[model samples]
Target: MFSLIYGFYKHMVQKDEYCVLILGLDNAGKTTYLEAAKTKLTNNYNSIHPSKITTTVGLNIGKVDVAGIRLNFWDLGGQNELQSLWDKYYEESHAIIYIIDSSDRERMDESKEIFDKMIASENLRGIPLLVLANKQDIPECMGVREVKPIFNKNSHLIGKRDCMVMPVSALTGDGVDEGIRWLVDCIKRNSYLRPPRNQEEM
Candidate 1:
C-alpha cells in the first residue's frame, strides 16, 4: 500500500514540460510573439505593447501552461552577430518556432539562407518546427503561400522532421494561440520525438 501511494503521489506531481526555441532574423518580431503568447496564455492584460518591443540582444524567456502542459519558450536574439548563438539551444529544444518578417521582402532570401542552415544542424533532427510569417497586419506583407516555396525547397533537410508555416500578426495577437496549439499537439502525438525523461516516470 505504501508503494502504491508513493506511485500515485509521484504521478500527481509529474508535470509535462517542453522547451521551445523561438528563432528568426533580427526585427522579425520574435520578441513580440513571445510576449504576446505569454500575455494570451496568462491573461496578463498589463503586458507591454508589442509594437514597443525592441530587438532582443540576448534572450527573452517566458512560460505558459496549456492543456496541463508547461511550455518554456526561449526567444533568442536574431541580429547578424547573434546568429552564432542559436545552435547552443538546438540540442535541448523539443520544438522550434521560427518567425519571419513578412513585409521585409528584400531580406526573404537572407532569411531562407539562415533557416536552411539552422535546420541542417544535426542537433535539430526530428524536432517539430513551426514557422510564423509574422507582421501580417502590414499591408505589404507576404502571405504564407508566398513564403512556402522559399522554405519548402530543401525538403530533404527536414525529411525526418515535421514542419508547418502559418501567417500571424504578433503585434495584433493573431494566430499565435493556434500556432502554439498546433505545436503542442504535434509534440504530444510524437512521444518518441520528446526529450528524454526520468526512467522512473517512463
Candidate 2:
C-alpha cells in the first residue's frame, strides 16, 4: 500500500521525474534559495511580498527542468505546527537538502536538533543528504571550518548516507551552482534506494 501511494506521488509530481526535499529552520532562506535559482536560470523573477515569505504554510512545490532532468523540488515550511507534514514524503524523496544560516550563531543548537530529527526519521536513513551552509556573504557568517565540527559530530550514524556541506550565498548566487549540481549528480547516480526483496522466490 505504501509503494502504491509512493508511485502515485511520483506520477503526480512529473513525468520522468526526480524529487528533492529541501528542509531547514524558519528564516533559513529556503524559499529565497529556490526563487533565486529560478531567477538566475531564467533571468526573470516575479517578486513575492515579504509578508508571504513569513507564511509558507505546508509546502511549496517547484518544477524545473535542468539538463534533461525533470526535477520536483519541495520547499517545506519550517514552522513547528507544519513539521508533521514532512514525514509524508520522506520515503518518497530521492534526496534531502538541509539548509542552515551560517551567520546565525545563536541558533546552531536548534539547527542541530532539527537535523537530528531528519537523521532519526527512519524513512531518511541511508539516503544522501546535501547540507547547505548558507549566508556565506554576510560578515557574521561562520566559516566552513567552523561548520565542519557540527557535521563531524553527527557523522557516525549516517550509514550509506553520502553527505556533503558547501557554503552558499543565495542572495548573491555564490556557490549555488555547486549545490544544485551536487543534487543532480546524486539523482543521476541512482542513489534513491536499494532493490526490493523477492522472498517468495527465495
Candidate 3:
C-alpha cells in the first residue's frame, strides 16, 4: 500500500526543469565538460575525446534527467568577445557552473576577474554557484586549495547564495559526479528561487 502511494505520487507530480549556465574563460574545458556529462547521463553514450573538443563558438545545449529532475545546460562560448553576451541569459538561469583551467596558471587572474563581475550581477543574486577547478588530471595543475583562495576575497558576493569549489577532470570524468550531485541538491532545496515558468509571470 505504501509503495503504491509513492508510485502514484511520482507519476502524478510533474518533474521540475532547471536552467543552468556553464561559464568560463576560453580553453577552460567548458565544452568538454558538457559533452562528458551528456555521454554519461544520456543513452547516446558515444565517447567524447576532450582533446578534440574545440572552443565553443556560441552556446552548446544539452539536457540530462537526474533523479527525476531535468537539467538544461547552456554551455556558452568563453571567448573574450562572447563574454558580453553572458548577461543576456542571466535572468533566466537558475544556477551557474563556472569552470576554470587549473593547469593554466597564467590565466587564473583573468578568470577570477570575470568571475567577480559575474557574481556581482543583480540578476544572479542568491543563485547557486558551482565552480569546477577543471583539468585536475594534468600534472602540475593547480588543485582546489590553490585556486579557491583566489575567489575567497569575493566570498561576500555569494554570502547569501549556495557556492562551492570542486576539483574535476573533464577529460577523465573524475569528481564531476560529486560536484553535480551537490548542485542538484542545492537547487532542490531552493526551488523557490527559480525563475517563473512563463515569461508573462516575470
- TM-score-superior candidate, 1 or 2: 1
lDDT of 3: 0.87
Stretches > 4 Å off in candidate 2: 1-15, 43-52, 191-202
Higher-scoring candidate on TM-score, 2 or 3 = 3
Per-prediction TM-score = 0.90, 0.81, 0.89
Give the local distance difference test score of model 1: 0.88
Candidate 3 segments whose C-alpha is farther than 4 A from its true place: 1-14, 195-202
Q: 17, model 2: CA deviation in Å?
A: 0.6
Lowest-lDDT window of 10 residues in candidate 3? 193-202
lDDT of 2 by residue, 40-74 (tens): 55435675543456557778887666765666789
lDDT (tens digit, per residue) of candidate 1 on 1-202 = 9999988987776667888999999999989999999988896557887657877889999988887677889999999889999999998888999999999999999999999999999998899999999999999889999998888899999787779999999999999999999998887776576653432354
lDDT of 3 at 147: 89
Task: Compare candidates 2 and 3 on lDDT and give the better one.
Answer: 3
Q: What's the true lDDT of residue 9 in model 1? A: 86
Give the runs in model 1 whose Cα sits over 4 Å from its true position: 1-10, 196-202
Q: Judged by TM-score relative to the true structure, which candidate is superior, 1 or 3? A: 1
Model 3 TM-score, all chains together:
0.89
- The Cα RMSD in angstroms, rounded to one decimal, for candidate 2 relative to the true structure is 7.7
Task: Kindly list the per-residue Cα lDDT of model 3 for residues 1-202, writing each as its tens digit.
Answer: 9989877776556467788899999999999899888877778678667767877898999887777688889999999999999999999888999999999999999999999999999999988999999999999999999988887778788778999999999888888778888998988877876742421211
